[model samples]
Target: MMSKEDKIYLELEDREFPFSYTDHDRKIVRAIVFDEEKKFYFVRIHRDDSFGKATLIETSGGGVEKGEDLETAIQRELKEELGAEVEILQEIGIVSDYYNHVHRHNINHYFLCKVRSFGEKNLMPYEIRDFHMESLKLSYEEAIREYEKCSNTKLGRLIAQREVPVLEEVKKMLLIN
Candidate 1:
């Protein structure tokens, strides 16, 4: 069994909603995806009032389908969201966050990934219509700013809480190696 120090676990509460519990769990895979230039790739989403009418930058990922391994799910999410083939350099750890308004808990598995190549994106219809999802590439400082800027929205706050620490961890790892 792994000790507490061996894993990075984050638990996030839903302060924006009055709901007190989560009824379902979602297993997800996300990446801090970078290219040879050291710029990171993310998804910029323009959402409506479901969360709020705001634009947000988020790590490119989604729910891991049944029977899909974490590696395969991350690979597929990158292909569909960013049109890039990535090399999974490291498994960062997990973030346990709640979407109380939706009654769902997210078990987010994060990875440090490097882009290998690019191709056409095959986005789902809902992702295109509902999220207005688009790919964004940003430097470390720019990404930090984007996260802070986007935190004006409810969903953005949750995303920033979940991702920013992981981003910092990845920075330290890169500096060490």
Candidate 2:
């Protein structure tokens, strides 16, 4: 069995809305992806609607599919988002956050992964037209700066709050500057 200290846990409130009900819980698998050269990989999403116009940087991940284990889910997510084959280096931890507007309680499972190769992305039609998703590769400092800069938006603030801590833990695990 794993010890408590082996992972970090976070509970985030819904800062955007004051809804008292969470109708559903979404179990997601995310990765802090890095290459042999030490560059990190993330997804940059551009939105221009109810959440407002903003470009947000976030880890690559999605909801865990039915009957899939966390490891399988993460590998599939990285492939779909980053278009890269990866080796999961470690399980970073879990972050439980609420999106009151959507009534979603997200239980995010984070992993540290090393890229093995890159290929074409299998992006969904909506991901292309709606989110305008693109891959971003940056050094540790650059990634942190991007996350901070993106925090100006409401959705961005929530994402930053959820992801930045996980990124910091990965940095410590990788011994990166």
Candidate 3:
């Protein structure tokens, strides 16, 4: 199995800090997805359920099902969330973090992909009803700004803290400011 320890970087005290942590329990795939016109796909999740906190903006992705390869899992996730077909450009990096909402450690595989086409979304019912998930296309800078805005609240900060490093990795690879 591919290990993510070599690729992990963490933040502490509001600064980028290099760190390494990995365990073999869960696999989630996150896409740093771009459209043909160069806009990135992002998900805005408005979680109003009993379990969730702030309305969150996040990159497009989901849990990888058992027996599915990473590539296939990403493809399925993109389609489900954004209703888009994507040509994966590269495996950007893996980010390790823990989600307080779920109280589980995450091993997230991040991929760079270009959207090939779009159609109707196929979101899970609770995701639609409770999370109120919505899809949006954003310029790289706009996406970063969304993160900044979400960081205002406590729960939002928890998610942003985990995602910002992955977003930074994407910016570094694409030279997006």
Which candidate has the highest lDDT of all?
2
What is the clash count of model 2? 0
Better of 1 and 3 by lDDT: 1
Per-residue lDDT of 138 in model 3: 88
Pairs with steric clashes in candidate 3: none
lDDT of 1 by residue, 68-125 (tens): 9999999999999999998999788899888888899899999899999999999999
Candidate 2, 26-49: lDDT as tens digits = 999999999988999999999897
- Candidate 2 TM-score over all chains jointly: 0.95
What local distance difference test score does each model get?
A: 0.89, 0.90, 0.76
| Candidate 3 positional error at 127, Å | 1.0
Clashes of each: 0, 0, 0
Estimated TM-score for each candidate: 0.94, 0.95, 0.82
Q: Between candidates 1 and 2, name the one with more favorable lDDT.
A: 2
Off by over 4 Å in 3: 1-24, 50-52
Query: Against the true structure, what is every candidate's RMSD?
Result: 2.3, 2.2, 5.1
